[model samples]
Target: MTDDPAATFARARAAAGVLFFNDNDQIMLVDPSYKDYRDVPGGYLERGETPRQAAEREVAEELGIHPELGRLLVADWAPSEAEGDKVLFLFDGGTLTKDHLDGIRLDPGELVGFQFHDIAHVHDLTISRLARRLVHAHAAHLDGSTRYLEHGEWI
Candidate 1:
């Protein structure tokens, strides 16, 4: 392998998402119009935008709500065979009040619908890797600590 720094390093794609919860401790998941599985409100980061900014933008674009996101819950480095290396950031979206939930407006172009799911059943609603990430994120939220994961597992 060549020693040139530029040639030796590969650029990894990045995505940011927010984990929203309700008073009942259920996680909010969004149904993307293009995906078969449910996901949190997030998307690929735009050019030059920070992960947090991307998360905020995605929530507004997908759900049409601008709730202030809290601390980082999980930073996962998950590399996929089809998508290549990816770094995902999950942020805390503090419990949503009834008013906030009532104001949700799903963007027809991006998300078809959104629902609250119990933590125990997150695996049934989303992909395995994502389910693991969400579970870790929820644990971090409860303990007020951040987590670093590789392929959705703590390392």
Candidate 2:
């Protein structure tokens, strides 16, 4: 039997991020220095890395804080026009204690700024698909369960 690399290769790209909240029920979002839209702290997964690992690592690289990420909040399948097919993962970053905030040291070259906002502002602050994804993720976090989404819609 012969193994075909074409059939075994990854068809979709994967990325992971974390959803952090505050006591007042706000979502933390970051403004990337290179992108126009605001987004959560994360990046694409490295080879052989799991989603959870990627989330934890990305947060540390971008925010300069090593937060304990919990179970996944959502795994979304979103295909972008520019990126083709992709699978996005979101993990629970839990509520930020004062220490978490105090520890933040944004990488100026990658992230310009970051802020917390009411859930309602997600639509206005992020890209359309990500806005939907975050809205669902925030809700899932409050409910203590993970969500399965397709381009941000509950599936």
Candidate 3:
């Protein structure tokens, strides 16, 4: 143990994202320029920002849209060798109207494009852990509940 109690704790990186669905119940995913796979509209939480605020800010910065986000859907504790430990939060973006969809303006510096995909194909498009998180987040949204997951699986 360390002399200072705070030094004994691990500092996990945290990120916040939103789950958006279209009228067809398809999930909206963004192709990030920095990553090989698609992801939801969100990014890491800045210092002095709440998870929800980070989510909202990321959406505006990445997509240039300001849709109201709903309740928390899923929170996952995922540890990665490359990224160290991480805590991820997913919020409900509700169903996007045509107008909301039309207003999307992708930030070319961060994202390439955005697409809507069938929920069944999520695993094919992203990493397994992220796919699991999306699946559980969608279920939580449908049932109006929240979920806690470890590495994207319920304990």
Report lDDT (CA) for all predictions.
0.95, 0.92, 0.95
Kindly indicate the candidate among 1 and 2 with the higher TM-score. 1
Model 1 misplacement above 4 A: 1-3
Which lDDT tens digits does candidate 3 get at residues 80-116? 9999999999999999988988899999999999999
- Our model 2 lands, by Cα RMSD against the true structure, at 2.3
lDDT of 3: 0.95
TM-score of each: 0.96, 0.93, 0.97
Q: Candidate 3 clash total?
A: 0
Q: Could you give the C-alpha RMSD of every candidate to the true structure, in order shown?
A: 1.0, 2.3, 0.8
Clash totals in order: 0, 0, 0
Query: Alpha carbon lDDT of residue 92, candidate 2?
Result: 85
Please rank every candidate by lDDT, starting with the best: 3, 1, 2
- Candidate 1 at 118: error in angstroms? 0.6
